[model samples]
Target: MSADQSVAIVDDDDFFRKALERVFHSAGFRTESFAAAEAFLASYIPKDEACIILDLRMPRLGGLELLDRLKERGIDVPVIIYTGNADVPVTVQAMQAGAYAVVEKPLSSELLITRVRAAITDARARRTRRNQSASARAKLKLLTEREIEVARHLTEGLSSPEMADLLGISPRTVDAHRANLLRKLEIRSIAALARLFVLTELGDS
Candidate 1:
C-alpha cells in the first residue's frame, strides 16, 4: 500500500477472495487473503492500519463468531462485513458488534475498496484511543487501595481534612496519599486525574 497499510480478506470462496485481493492491490493496498476466519485469527497480528473484509458464511468459524473472538482478545481492528448472504438480521448483528461497514456482495470493486480505506482509517483511530486508555489504566494501577480512595475523594472536590474524615484517617495521612497517588500517576493536576477516571471508568469507580 502507498501508506504502508494493508487490507485482509477472510472468505472461503477462493475466486472471490483472490478477486478482492486483486482489486485492493490494484488500488495501492497491501492485501492478505485467508480461506477462513480461523486461519486469519491464527496468523493476524493486531495492526492499527489494517482492516478486515469478512464473510458471514464460512466453513469453520463464521464472521460473527470471529468478531466475538476478536473482542475477547481485546483486538480493536476495524471490520467490513462483505457477504453474499447479507440480510437485515445479519447486518444489524455485525453493526451492533462494531463492524465499520457492511456490504452485500455482488462484488463491487469500487465500493469495496472505498469501504476498505474507510475501515483502515477507523481502525487507526480506535487503536489511538485504546492506547491512550491503556496508558491511563496502567498509571492508575500504580496506586494502592488507600491511595485510590484518596484519589476518588479528590475527584469529588474533597479537601484533605474532608478526605481524612471520610476515610477515618489523619489529615496528614490523607495529604500523603494524595501526594503519592499524584506522583505515581505522573500527573500534577487534580482535574487531569479526574478526567482520566471519567474516560476509563464509570459508576462508583
Candidate 2:
C-alpha cells in the first residue's frame, strides 16, 4: 500500500466502528469512519489505495445495496462485508457482487487488520494496473490508421509477408509499418503488443 492508503469503516454500531478505528490506528494505518452507507456515498471520496469495511445490516442503504451501487458506479474498491448474523445466501450474494471477503461479527482485531491490509494492498495493485492500461490506451491512440491496421495484424500472429499479402502491400512496406509500430508502442516483441490488447480490454471492469 502507498503511504496515503487508508481504510474506510462503514457501520452503524458506534462500539464496533470505534474498535476498528482504534485497531487500524494502532497498526499505523490511516482510516475514515462512516455511521452509515449513505453517509459514505454522500461524501463520494474516491481513493485509489483504499478498501472499505462495510457492515451488512445497516438500515436503508445496507451492504448489499451499497455493493450494487458501487458496481453500478464502476467502483472496484475491495470490500470486506461484516455481519453479525451469518446468513448463507447473503454471504454468497456479497461474494458474487464482488466483495473481497466476508467476516462474521465478533471479528478478532488481529484478523480484521490482516484482511484490511490485504485488501488495501490488492486495491493498490489494481489501481496500478488500471493506470498502466489507461496509459497504454492513450499511447495506442497516437497510431495512424495504417499503423493501427498493422498492429491488429501483428496481434493476429501474421508475418510481414502474410500481412502484406492480405493488405495488397509490398512485404518491405509491411516490415516498415511493423518497425514503426514497435517503436511507437515502445514494445519489443509481437507477443508483448498482443498482451497489451488483452490487458487493456479487461480493464473495463
CA error at residue 91 for candidate 1, angstroms: 1.6
In candidate 1, clashing pairs total: 0
Tens digits of per-residue lDDT for model 2, 39-81: 9988857677787989998988999899999988888789999
Instruction: Report the number of the highest-lDDT candidate.
Output: 2
| Model 1: residue 98 alpha-carbon error in angstroms | 5.8
Model 1 worst lDDT run, 10 consecutive residues: 196-205
User: Could you tell me the TM-score of candidate 2?
Assistant: 0.84
lDDT over C-alpha atoms for residue 60 of model 2:
88
User: Model 1, range 104-174, lDDT digits (tens) per residue?
Assistant: 98867887777777777756665666667777777788889899899988999999998888889999999
Task: State, as a TM-score between 0 and 1, how close model 1 is to the true structure.
Answer: 0.76
lDDT of candidate 1 vs native?
0.84
Please list all clashing residue pairs in model 1, or write none if there are none. none
Regions of candidate 1 where Cα sits further than 4 Å from its true position: 12-15, 35-46, 58-76, 96-98, 202-205
